[model samples]
Target chain A: MTIRILTEGELRSCVDIDREAMETVASGFRGLGEGRAVLPPILRLDVEDANGEMDVKTAYVPGLDSFALKVSTGFFDNHKLGLPSLSGMMTLISAHTGRVEAVLLDNGYLTDVRTALAGAIAADTLARRDAKVAGIFGTGLQARLQLRALALVRPIERALIWGRDPEKAAACAQEMAASLGIPVEACAEGSAVCAEADILVTTTPARSPILQAEWLRPGQHVTAMGSDAEGKNEVDPQALARAERLVVDRVSQCARLGELHYALEAGLVEETQAVELGDILVGKAEGRCSDEEITFCDLTGTGVQDTAIALFAHCRAQARGLGAAIEA
Target chain B: MTIRILTEGELRSCVDIDREAMETVASGFRGLGEGRAVLPPILRLDVEDANGEMDVKTAYVPGLDSFALKVSTGFFDNHKLGLPSLSGMMTLISAHTGRVEAVLLDNGYLTDVRTALAGAIAADTLARRDAKVAGIFGTGLQARLQLRALALVRPIERALIWGRDPEKAAACAQEMAASLGIPVEACAEGSAVCAEADILVTTTPARSPILQAEWLRPGQHVTAMGSDAEGKNEVDPQALARAERLVVDRVSQCARLGELHYALEAGLVEETQAVELGDILVGKAEGRCSDEEITFCDLTGTGVQDTAIALFAHCRAQARGLGAAIEA
Candidate 1:
């Protein structure tokens, strides 16, 4: 009956953007595809006065003993007050007794890691096997974590960074080159990112298309993990139509907020053309038919990822004796 | 940032079934009626294996500094193992920064208090000014709380308790008589309880109508607070058709899961016939027009009440220095 409370620093000590995390998320997707999971639509509350939005996401995977209910808040104006714009906590409930067992005060750390791992999962499932070049569009924490995650699954040896702010992208490039021990360059033209990189990830918060359909080439795999909202579009709608294969985290969600939403709106690509990452992971649908075929994946975050990552981090924290267990 | 954790005992010490608590929940409804509150649709996760359901409810009221995000779980089979069927916790988030301020581990104590008070609000507004006898249909905790709450707002000299189990109802009646210092009687006939009581509250789990419309009379007000699922009904739909005034916690929710749902499905009442309790609380809609009017208010509950009650408890707990604050 005691509930464990784990902090962000403690979770960061155990859970990382690694292979274990990838498979943890991959297992949730497998359950989703195999039809053994229950994922409810996200509950979102928006406050116009504070420019804030709080999203509640959760899912139940049968094999797992407990489910994670995560409350994530994003107050866009927090930066002006010297506070991080995003913060959240997760409550893990026992499936058998329906009692809460733990409170994860990760403050969005688990979310950041899980999101990065999902990007890696999409790339590992859809990208060319011998793909060595990695490129990302955002110069932020996700930009660094995604490439680092890609290196864990793909044979990524060189990387390119693209950003609206060239200085930030250049700084990101230098950091990635030193940390990853690979050749990382800040590209001046966006088309070069679409053309040269075997694996391209758009991590920006662009409202309009940053990656164009005309710039894409054969054998290229695109993973757009940048933004998710009704208005967020990183790649052109036509870009999805240009790819030989299109994949999504969830077709239903992506059809509403992901790249496929715009594609379906413009009559460029039908929703049926896109296969979910879960279906591919479970072999229920086809992934890459050939290395020569272009692939594109839109990454809109899911509740199952949160549940899987939270449970994984909770287990690690418990094993390491890193959290406080108050018998309240 | 720090999160204060308050347990059930601490919450009960400060928050109670009283006038102050009534006003706190009343203010939330007023804000909701004034069109300043933001309530998101509830998110639910069902686990068929365990016969469990996890419900997440939240709301944002502009004037309240923090809004509450509540996670409630119900596992029906837990009683076999000597556990309560329902358990939950509420997290209060700062509306200014969207930061976690406290976690109220009330374990559904706050929900019970708020729910009972909502029944009082309905009775106080719609019941006759001369209401002296309060009757409830269930023999559980709510059966007692509703009468206690009604006593706060009305001049009640006696109370009636009705249930499927006559022995349990008689025991509850004796216990209530000793506690409330009122003449309490457990009646075998549900029709007798309906005919004698001026204010009636249904808190049962019965699937069929326990209160018949043929027995209802003028100058009587009914508060049906039991069972919120699709198939549960404690009062007949025809009873609503007979009522002079009809009120609901929220029309959208009532249309889907409340007594109004059943009434609408039976084509006995129109959706527009039911006015929100908030509207009456804020003077946006009319309540009881005459002493001879038969009023029925359906209380399916709302997120605003959670936000209000949690905030009230947090403020009192802070004033009394009652919780453990962890700087995680």
Candidate 2:
């Protein structure tokens, strides 16, 4: 058996924020929600002494020929050593023989792409058809990708970016405007952007809430994808309580560790009110019943998405002959 | 960053059952037992439809320069398709930058070696110094490996082999006798072998207890390395209850999933009675205070062992220039 190796640059050249990838991620969620996928709870290790942590996420979706096991690490203090904070690779294994078939050393670029695609999936399923103005918080890699992803699902032509560091936010707007072919503005205040946004995305790792309930509008849709780990909250608990429809990427995870943990802890929202994003795609639950309905999605990321994107990347890499295969 | 790829053949040539590798595994356990290692709980995914399962194991020993994430899969029904029952690989990553360092496509060879070394560690610590007659149950790879490992710790001169298949037992005895330079006897009954043996090792996947408490003799040290998952037992619960000293690879794990679970479930053993194997290695606890004491150790396997073995293989491969490093 031989294993394919795709480098970060190779994966970036083959994988992009596109419609097919978004649909593939959507189907992955549907597989989980429809009871055809086996997703184990994430295994996380915290190396507090080194100010680092690692998470292993995996899932087996029956119809897929392969499954992926992704090991992602976050060394928060790596920046001091001139290293990236996030680094990871995915190992794709054949379902039949359980042998590894490919290793994607994307350094977390594929993770960012799949995560952004999941945001597109949520928006395509819940956001209003004519949603044009997007308000994005946190001007990081995810912030840039999410805006581009939102454009694929909604008619988002302009975006207002906000960050704790105003200079970074302004730089993000200028780069996104040039790359995405849209007018991007930097907002001095987060609330100012939230007030005019047809769709809102909160992508900050904050101990306290960054987006409040009062900033929400009737036709606005919100995608909160930042508060994945415990004790991290991006959207206020009251925002979920006041939303007409509250959805989560995975109910099993969000209820315990994601943003919903705080919402459930504060007794602002009942667990039953949070429908799964997969259920909406699989026609098991209603999504965006009316354009006036305020829809919110809490995405903590899921194993199924990793498997979907990894398999997709492998297929694309093989077709383009973009990776090297070493026979073992 | 690039990852070094070591095939199964390459890793096999580089890694072996030796004093240095065994010592490395011992230090890993010591790190865990001394609270200097971050070992995460195993993440297991069960694919009932495909009759397959996968486990993700990893650990961080602060003293080690790198950590490993091992993805092992067990597809029992794969034999029908002419494939092995278990397949796996270990990915070694940098502890400082969390970058990919090497991938050992060992095909479960390293896992078996580390597991066998753990058996040796248990025997070296808890077994009597004069243990010369080893009684082994099972005719699989682990049975052969454990016997070789036992020779490293004790002055074994002979082995009594017992198996469900008598033909396999006879074959095992013949092969072991020729290779190990020891007299090996094939016993028709398990009781017969257990009666005269100084050291006993159970390496089968039997669901129910195979080694009876009545067969255990004084001064005998038994290592149960089979029962890793819930509801799997190799030694009878009564045997553990009757032992003078009981040690577990990991108390938190063995208490819930290892052979100790059955002993605890039978209400014959207290959780506190099961000391960690590393505790004895680190001199924090006594191991076999008397030659007459019957000691038992449960080896469910842990992430620390995987990390240690992976690092050992990576370093050996690098020194020998046995692997190919592809720049990412």
Candidate 3:
């Protein structure tokens, strides 16, 4: 048997946060919404001594010839050792023969790309058509990607950034300004950014809520993509209660590990009140009912997205003949 | 990051079913017995179209520097395509860093070695000291390995083989006779094999009992290693009730998917009556107490065994510099 190996650079060269990639990911959401995909719960492993954890996510979509199974690592103390805090790889297996087709050593790149695209999908379906200002939390890799991704869907003219470190936030703002050719500024508090922007995306790994309910204004859409694990929350539970509409990537997962977990814990949200982004994308559920409605979407990330992004990466890399192939 | 890829031939050249290999797998049992290993439940996915299923098992032992995550495939229809019914690979990651250190593309070779070694460990700990004859059920790769592994510790001078097909059983017996320098014969009845042999092993994909309770004679020991999934049983549940001592690889796992599941359903076994193979290995529980006592062990396999065997293979392959390393 022959298996292909795609390095991070090869994958980066083939896939980008563009329209084709967005549509590829949108099909994944549609598959999940239509119940044509088999997405299992995350298999998690914890290495207590190193203060690191690994999450294994996978999904099988019959429409695709291959499915992606991802292993994502979070070593919180790796930065002290001059290594990045996040590193991982994805494996694609043939849906027909049950053999591994390729291994993508993306080191969390595909995860970042797919995560950013999910934010754009959420905003495109829920945000007002004329929304121009964006607010971003966390000055990490995702912070920059989220802003760029938003610009692709909405008329994002400028953005406000908030982070724990003021200098890092300012640096991120300057970097985004140069990349997007839009005015960007660092905000001292998340509340200020939340109240002023038309679209707000929280990308921080905060254990406590960063945005409050009172800060949520009408004609605004919020997407929380950072809370993919337990004990991680970005928006206040009261905010979920106050929003005119609440949506999630997957109701079962969000209620267990995302911002919706806290909202459910506080009895501020009902299980039935939540709608899925997949359903909204396929027009099975309403997204933005009115321009004055406050919309909230909590993304815990799903295996369907991984399968979509990995399959897309494979096709692109094969077309370019960019990855290494080995016989087994 | 650098990942070493070891082909099946490279791995086979370095490791075998020797005493050192058994001890390596033994340490895994010790870790689990002492409550120092973190083993998560298997993540399983089913592909209906291919008539196949995938099992992902992993474990972290604090005493080991590296842990193994294994993905195994069982495609029931692969033989019709001139391929093996089972295939898989294992990945070893640093316990301290949670990084993918190496991928052993053994294509189920490592699993086979570890599984056979588990059978040896069970027989060595539970069989009579002077046992000289063995009875093997099934005519698969595992049936042969179980016999070869049993001889490493016992005075096995002769063996009886049984299978659904008489020609395959005869061929297996001839093969074992040539390799082991012992008298091996094909038996027509599983009951006759069970009643005569000092040690018995069942290694078939049987959905019903193959060995009856009345056939279980005193001074005979049975090791059933084929019932790793639900709806597979080799020994009658009544045999479990008749045996003087009942052991399992892992109590909770066996209770859910092994022979113990059927026994528990039939009210022939009690949850508290079962003892673990690890506890037996560590002297925490008693093994065969007398030559007249009948001992039976049900092995459904464990992730700890994978970690132990994979770490051993990685060390040997690295020492000999037998694998290809890729920098990412």
TM-score of each model, in listed order: 0.99, 0.99, 0.98
Give the 10-residue window scoring lowest on summed lDDT in candidate 1 chain B. Answer: B227-236
lDDT of each: 0.91, 0.92, 0.90
TM-score of chain B of each: 0.99, 0.99, 0.99
lDDT of 3 by residue, A66-183 (tens): 8888888888888788888788888888877677788888889999999999999999989999999999989999999989999999989989999999999999999999999999
Q: lDDT tens string, model 1, B145-171? A: 999999989999999999999999999
Point out where model 2 deviates above 4 Å: none
Off by over 4 Å in 1: none
Which candidate model has the greater DockQ, 1 or 2?
1
Q: TM-score of model 3's chain A, to 2 decimals?
A: 0.99
Which is the winner by lDDT between candidate 2 and candidate 3?
2
- lDDT of model 1 at residue B1? 87
Better of 2 and 3 by DockQ: 2
After TM-score superposition, the amount by which residue A125's alpha carbon in candidate 1 deviates from its true location, in angstroms, is 0.9
- Please give the TM-score of chain B in predicted model 2: 0.99
Instruction: List pairs with backbone clashes in candidate 3.
Output: none
